[model samples]
Target: MKKIGKTLKSACVLGLSGALLVCSVGCSSSSESSGGEKTGKKQLVFWDKSEYVTAYNDMMKEKVDEFAEKYDVDVDYVIVNSGDLEQKLAAAIESGNQPDIIMGDNTSVAEYIASDQLAEVSDVLADIDLKEEAKPYAVFNDTEYLVPLSLTAPGMFARQDVWEEHGLEAPKTWEELKEQAKIINDPDNGFYALGLPLGESGGGDAETFIRTIILDYGGEVVNAEGEVTVNSPEVLEAFKFIASLYEEGLVPPDATTWDDSGNNSAYTAGTVGVVFNSGSLMGTLKDEYPEIWDNTAIFDYPAAEEGGQSYTLGGANVFGIFKTGDNTETAKEFISYFFSDTDFYNEMVEAIGGMWQPVINGYDDTEFWQDPDNAVWLTAASNLTLTTAPAPTTDTAAQGFSNHLCTKALQNIVVNGMDPQEALDGLEADLNELYQ
Candidate 1:
């Protein structure tokens, strides 16, 4: 509850400042305006995240250069750190200094739509082969806005060698998962069975994990009709289950304070037997620890009950056009061209590596996606399901995520020793107020 209090205070401060105070820090913008202005070329501003991934940045530069050459546009390409994107975007929106085209986490797109800062791209989507299931975060009020670039399904991963040493198979049911975790729990040697990031400081991973369990149990924070349902019986079961993981000594004590990278570091350090994370963990294991990489295995999140459906929290990154920008047509054309060019898109996907999986309909047939090493994760991505959030409902879900609602509720139980029902009741109250 203390952590939640701090989060609410921080959010309030940010809101008062219009969430733009951090926009100037580490801000860098580059322009290819040179002689293009003299030639009457249109000026297009493009912003993307991931400033540290050299390969991704290089690929983006190459693509932007090609776009400029083909379309006669002066592109101002800005690379913002992903963590800083929300604030930077908020500042840009507040000041009316919007980029023509921007790529961001799918959640941010929902927030932008809530604020009416995005330009509609229904005409662009009509020309493309956008899949129905893939349209959840990209559409609002029956009009398309986001061009989903790629997605990731964060599923469960385990150290195969450890499981083999313990003579255990990957758990298919939540009960079996817990039983196996209890068997593997050995904190005396600095090891734990589960790498659950329950801390609100862990960023969205905790919320995603909690929501995945809730969805698996046939519960949701908000139903299709947009009513707050956090206190449903299924959600209570999910909450008590999460608390049991900690109370039974399966999760490490430090999980209460670990940030977004906590579980990743814990698993990499050989301190955890199983971790629920994105496919990127496979990439890390492959690059930094080949021994573990060879023995690593992935599986879908264990089912909530023996016969229940399995679900993994999923999301995507999207390309969007700003309503305030004057280059809407140019932005739409570039998005269309990027998606339609199969070769270029595949090359970009390769460059992106585990950061995102292909979102297009036919990419499952691509050689890159068919590799044996990617089997587990590819299956996970293909089966990913998302919570429905339409129009006004979408805005509430985005705010819930941004506010770390579920994570806070889990912390209230695990850290503050509050009753699971009470924590859930508080969560329901908060959400009802938010969704209202």
Candidate 2:
């Protein structure tokens, strides 16, 4: 929600390396050793990309320290930008100087696993089904290599005050969203009924926002075969609908240059009624801005047409042990300890402020999720997904495609104004290239 400052304005594939790649990783060499011997306790280096990892890292270290005292092991936690993990891992891949554990995603995680750089952790959390949302990135070559950290799906949110003032509820259908957008877009009153930050690099934010709308309209960004299928007629209609929103003046003109915050800004300022992103925002909103916080509400992606479902995408941060690291067994042991213990998992979540939903807890009793604070996320999680959960389909293809397609493909469409069909066509062609 920080004002769009240093982030690039586009979400294109060419820019994926820039946007999602590590901008800079906060690393510590204290746990490092002089050669093959480690000095301090039986410590292991664990790194992942998450600015929101403060509490989790601390708790992780706490658990590791406890384990270290009991089992004689050391766990030093390091924070890296999500984008940086790939860059650093790519550099360290050939050097065999990798950390004992790497935390990333299926897309990013695949590179390590494919090269035999990661341990097959099938035994670590064998009891964990990992749910579908996690499978896409967690499993590779039918072998599980990662531990899932959270339940992830993008969510839609709005200012509760704006909804009440406009006599609206979360739109159940796409038409209703559009209709609601019309009423909120009374420019004379300094409001936009809806938001689409087009300026986030050639509509990068627009592309993501629009992709959900496309799903609502019956489009699938990823198919069962793990290939991109966004060029279909159903998706074309979705894209055309987006273009129409732009032409109809539903989106702010300045949206194209904005980063993720444009929508956040407008919503918090009461200038816009609705926006879609991670529900994690609710926690931050609660912590920082209290006055307008109560006006917030969560929404499912509205259905396209009337009966269609809304499906937004989300990714999870994963934990993996490197094949080259010194303490391979210990690394896996810590991860096992992390997941098998429910209290430890909750501590991590509480520390991270629900920025992540525990993946292993997918079958978490429906009871706690109904708490007023979690009500919106529970609904948003259920509403924004087309599936019970999202686990990736084509393992190799998913990761390679992610590094090759996912963010970049969407970026191309957003920045290039590449015709939705043509853009996706190009993405398909690229997927074949990676597959080869």
Model 2, 1-436: lDDT tens digits are 3344334344354486664444432123332443335555565777756654467666776776776677766556777776467678777766766788877654566566667788888887676656554555566666777777765555677777777887887888877888888877877877777776765332134545655665667666566555556568876776667766666777676665666667777766777767776655666677777777777776766667556655665556678888778888888887777666776776566556555665654434545554666655544444333221222443455454344343354445555666667766876677566555
Instruction: Estimate, for each residue in 1-436, the C-alpha lDDT of model 1 and write its tens digit.
Output: 9999999999899786764644433242113234234568787889997733467778887888898899877888999888788789889878877898899777766678777878998888776775555667576645677888877667677888888999998888888999999898889999999998877765478878888888887788887777777788988998998899998899999898877789999988889988888767767777787787777787657887777788766777788899887778888988887777877776776666655667766666667767765655667766766633322436667777878888898899999999999999999988888877
Q: Could you tally the backbone clashes for each prediction?
A: 0, 28
- Compared with the true structure, the alpha-carbon lDDT of candidate 2 equals 0.63
Reference-based lDDT, each prediction: 0.78, 0.63
The alpha-carbon lDDT assigned to residue 283 of candidate 2 equals: 62
Give the CA lDDT, 0 to 100, for residue 394 in model 2. 39
- Which ranges of candidate 1 are over 4 A from the true structure? 1-39, 51-53, 387-393
